[model samples]
Target: MSAIFYIDQLPNRTIDHDGQAYLFFSGTAYLGIPQHPDFHQLMAESMRRYGTVFGSSRNGNVRISVYEEAESMLATRIGAESALTLSSGMMAGQVVINWLQSQHYTFVYAPKAHPALWHAPTVTLPQLAFADWTAQLPGQLSALSPGPVAILVNSLDAVCSDYYDFDWINQLPDNRPITLIVDDSHGLGVLNNGRGIWPTILQKSVDKPASVRIVGTGSLAKGMGLPGGVVFGDANAIQSIRQTAFFGACSPMPPACLDAFLRADALYAEGQERLQRNIKLAEHLLLPTGLFHQASGYPVFFTEHDALYANLLQKNILIYSFAYPTAADRANTRIVISAFHEVADIEWLAESIFG
Candidate 1:
């Protein structure tokens, strides 16, 4: 079987297909805003205010004030000096990488780093676990000639529900300038009380010299429930990226989404609280079974059980199950808990799994 299922409507806590409704425990909607009535209402209202799309280039003569406003709000929320918004998370990374590449810095990538951070056509990643890669980074960086180096990595290993330690970043030698690019698509709006790992990374660099620079990029689609992406860094770095033809040439994110985001602070807080409660409930119910891997405070859980998907489907439940990154890779089956899931929905899922 191809392991594909199609449905007409978006999946939130439940998915309906072929006249059957199934408990949906999949997708990147950790905050569960897809079917959120409040968010929908906000979106509709924002559309009335900003229109569905702002079809002009960011560098055009007439500029929309909301982009700067939203970027400032995002920077304040994430504890960054500045922020830039884009159409998607992937473009956010490419925009950064494009600017960094122009500076002629040597690129060092972590194992299985997202393709958005890839700099060249023929790049090869080290065949090692993230821990092994982190442990060896200092040595590798020290070996390189003292010039410029860009280190790329993710805030968390989303595939296997693992969180990585980046204490090694602060311990690196300061002989060369270092730019750390973190793809926090899975971390922003979900980790560290919704501030994400930006604050933690800032703390790590507090004692370090000015040679080390940090840049955070990610998709707001997951936890934020926005169909856009963002980049966070110092003002100078952000200005350089903004000047690039790439940033100016690409279309901007929907003005309506940014408008809604600016006004959704209370709504986001409510969703985050609900998501935390659901995550705790799921941990209590599912962790003892020893059938999954998870990170503390993260909503996604993973299991290697090939039968779990079909089994859950039989019980009117649907989880994410598929080969990822490539067809040769082993299929990944995960159970994703969201804010939209009620206590009763979780209890039902547990009963089905345990049975």
Candidate 2:
């Protein structure tokens, strides 16, 4: 492990640490909206109009209208019938999970599902690889007799840049109600041209029985660069989530952030375009070296080289290298490409790695 370097300012394409400048490639800011001048201007303008935060609950008599407006826009973008906004993505997942708890559904978790989507002592196939889990899931679900089942999974393994396929959903027996809960914190605004996993899953589940329900939760802070989270589902699911005590009691996302998100369509489009180009370039430059594992159209790149973090630090480049979810977990060392990274920044990163 390398010594921690802290910066006083937000890291975009570069960071300054101890009087040294380094190309920065760490964080969940997939669209690079946090430090973008236009985005900052938008937020500043929104803050003036909407204030920095809305301390009231969603169920309060006085409500800010931007929540509904932004949620509506999110639903349209994600191709869901409805969407709900929360203070953070973790809260969004918890809201849905809390609501589902009362319904008496047996929970089924996919391997590597984010902790936000975890229920108490989740049931999973220990030591089972992702591919094997998917292959054997149908039989396992069938064995869980007559009760309704809720399936929890992360849309993609952010740790390894591996995307999960949902084609197996069609294979599950549909006699009983089935709920698919996906944590898309790493997917929204980064995958599927910025629309995320809903549309793709919708297509794959076309042949599934009507009893299967799909609900998605994710942080807008990642790809969208908003300071909140969201839940996407059909009208009934959103309604049920809204009715939960967790939803009624929790504070909503800042109105300024939501307002900025609503107005940043052009900014998001530009960011996505820039990010795609970066991903292509990074793949072209780095994948052939057989050092990093990358998914098509995803920004994160993963490598297992133990000394790479320290080696890159000496080269004046900073990438994410630490345990996630818990300090007990092994360190995850990877490069995160953002829309703010210029072509030369990536070239420098490549050179630093293998030069």
**Residue 232 of model 2: what lDDT?**
93
Per-model TM against the reference: 0.97, 0.97
Per-residue CA lDDT of candidate 2, range 311-335, in tens?
A: 8888988899998767767899999
How many residue pairs clash in each candidate at the backbone level? Answer: 0, 0
Looking at model 2, the pairs that clash are none
Off by over 4 Å in 1: none
Best by lDDT: 1
**What would the per-residue lDDT of candidate 1 be over residues 1-355, giving only the tens digit for each residue?**
3357789989978888889999999898888776789989999999998898888899899999999999999999999999999999989999999998888889999987887788875468888999999888888988887689999999988988998887787687778889999999988888988888898888777776578888999998888899889999999999989999999998999999999998899888988999999999999999988898999878988998868999989998998888876676688888999999999999998889899
lDDT of each: 0.89, 0.88
Candidate 2 local Cα displacement, residue 355, angstroms? 1.6
Model 2 RMSD vs true structure: 1.4
For model 2, what is the C-alpha lDDT against the true structure? 0.88
User: What's the residue-level lDDT of 54 in candidate 2?
Assistant: 86
How many pairs in model 1 have backbone atoms within 3 A of each other, for residues 3 or more apart or on separate chains, i.e. clashes?
0
Worst 10 residues of 1 by lDDT: 1-10
